[model samples]
Target: MADTTTGSTEQSTVPRWRIVGPGLVVAATGVGAADLVATLIAGQKFGYTLLWCVVVGCVMKIVLVEGAGRYSLATGRTIFEGWRSLGAWTTWYFGPYIVIWGFVYGAAAMAGTGLALAGLLGGLSVTWWGILSGLLGLVLVWSGRYGVFEKVLAAFVGIMFVTMVGAALLTLPNLGELLTGLAPRIPDGGLVNTLALAGGVGGTITLAAYGYWLREKGWDTPSYMRVMRIDNSVAYVVTGLFVLATLVVGAELLYSTSVAIESGDQGLVDLGVVLQDRYGEWAGKLFLLGFWAAAMSSLVGVWNGVSLMFADFMTNLRGGTSEDPDARAGGKWYKAYILWLTFPPMVMLFLGKPVWLILAYGVLGAFFMPFLAITLLWLLNTDRVPREWRNKLHSNVLMVLCALAFLALCVNEVRKAVVGA
Candidate 1:
């Protein structure tokens, strides 16, 4: 499968610990503040009963991401390239999906970052803050240097881990109950919540960007498979820990109390205020900072990673391969998407998201996970990837389960969007 389209062949001599770039970027990017809020809500509603779901979510992500990385390394191809090999239909599905997904997601991510900054600094409109956040992300990713982008994402992940996990520890949750949460007993009336927490933790379209990051990190050959697997596992384990800690905070801090918070990003602000009143101002501010880190990390992650994917997609759209200059980092298509993610979305900040746009975004977004799962299953099982890297029976089982799980979630989301519309 090695071909001229595959780029440089530099083998990684760095130890596994030092080879943690793309995995961390993908993992951090996947766990935005919204994910934290979902985990918090899970804890609030069901206490430790659904902690097992968080673990399940993390495992599922690891499986899917690892499959993506494995395919890229084994075949020396981008995920986009693999999808194209599937058929022209994949291109048709992805083309409009990415455009719509980006416009909606850009606004959502910027707003999320703005909400965090507004909560932390105060005295500023969230819309303006969101605009500023989008601009900052633009500048950061516009450089097109993967090394710098990875480091920035790493710093943000550090802040998020410290603040969130620290807050959870401060709550001093019961170890016994936390352990029992691993037993997988769903509480009464907790089906949807259980599915969401199990299937939704740290999940996003960015998971598909793992292979791009792996290529950027120079892990583009089959020899790097073990390292890729290790990197993916470690990264999601950290992701799971961060998410679990947030659950602890919700269970100990909110579940036991009578305090009620609103839904969405604003709910996080409400929780921060509760922390201030109950645990003192410092605790609240720390959580707010963590929230900002989560949001900003996601912004940076998507800005860099998705732009790379878009570049690859554009290259393939024009009959060029992943090795085309336009598909690489700092290429024209890469910068173009950076601008798209930054500027156009700012309009939503001022005009507010249109009802139709929201409906379209929701409908398109609902299909991405299952789309990714089904594609991965197909690409991996076929001759597109080397036989050595083909999905094992266990892997195939997990992929099938992942597909079914995301399909169910997709149906649920579509139902909500249609009903809400």
Candidate 2:
């Protein structure tokens, strides 16, 4: 499994700090504005009792995402191709889901980004910002290659990491309780909440986008595996800290204040107000700005990364190539999905999401992580990759745990959504 980049081997020597590439972008992309509000609410409602869940969530995703990148670099094959080797059913599940998910998710994500902007601009409504942000994503992705995209996203990660963590530091939380959160205990009635937080913290279908990002980053070979591992560890470590900081904010401010936060983006807005009251107006504004950066990073990330994913999916379906031409950003299939993601779903914005569509998205989306885990478990262990690069016993155990966690979380989500549990 190897790739020859556009330059000589000397170009491969990236700086340690600048090694934050696709993994960081994908991880940042996966954690949306809504997720921040969710984590904050969880912290507020339960204090840091759920903090361990965030760490678990990061670990679980690291296994899955690192596996995805390893599979690609080790096999010299696209994740779509790797999945195809498993069987046709992989294509079937991925095809419609990518299309439908792209349509609905584009609107939802843009709206989420827009909500954060609207919070900043007191008079502006979300719909206007949603349209603007969508167009901005379109233009940025349309104009740049993967390197440019990675740099911009990394900057956003910096903004998000600094402000949230800085605010958390200011609160001066109880160190003892914070340390206790590392012990992995589930508080009363917290079983479902713990699972949800564990599954939700920086975990999303964007994990699949890792391979595409790896390819884009020129890490398309087995030698890049060590670098990929380092890249992934650093990315998730940053994510873990961001999640911890959110937990700290929840524990220190909302928990003791008895502040009740609503679900969705408004909860973040309310949290911002709470920040203003406690830390000062600038603190609230800064938090919201950071919140917007986090949300928009995810937006730009998905807009660019997942569009690459859908392009590959479409290319594979038509028996076309995913490299050199069709797979590049601004290529035919990539732009097509970008349009698919940005435009058609606007109908949902006004008409309200059709119940069936919502159900399908939930059912399909809920099971994707399990699907990814199971597929990678099989794909990586096979001759598709050299034995040396294949999963060791310890890696397999982590993946098995990932599969089971996703399986349980999927069942919980399905039942909860369908039966109103």
Best by TM-score: 1
Instruction: Give the poorly placed runs of model 1, Cα more than 4 Å off.
Output: 1-12
| lDDT of each residue in 240-285, candidate 1, tens digit only | 9999999999999889885667778998999899889988999999
Off by over 4 Å in 2: 1-12
Candidate 2, clashing residue pairs? Answer: 29-298
lDDT of 2: 0.83
Q: lDDT of model 1 at residue 242?
A: 96
Q: Estimate the TM-score of every prediction.
A: 0.96, 0.95
Expressed as tens digits, the lDDT of each residue in 1-421 for candidate 2 is 1222243353367667757687788889988887788788889888988888988898888888889998887678888889898899998899888887887788887787778899887676787788778888887788548878888898899999999999899899899999998888888988877887888767577898898888888888776776787788788889989988988998899897898878887888888888999889999999989988987898888889889988888887788877757866778889987787777877666677888887888888888989999999998788988787788888899999889988998998788668766
Minimum summed lDDT over a 10-residue window in model 1 is located at: 1-10
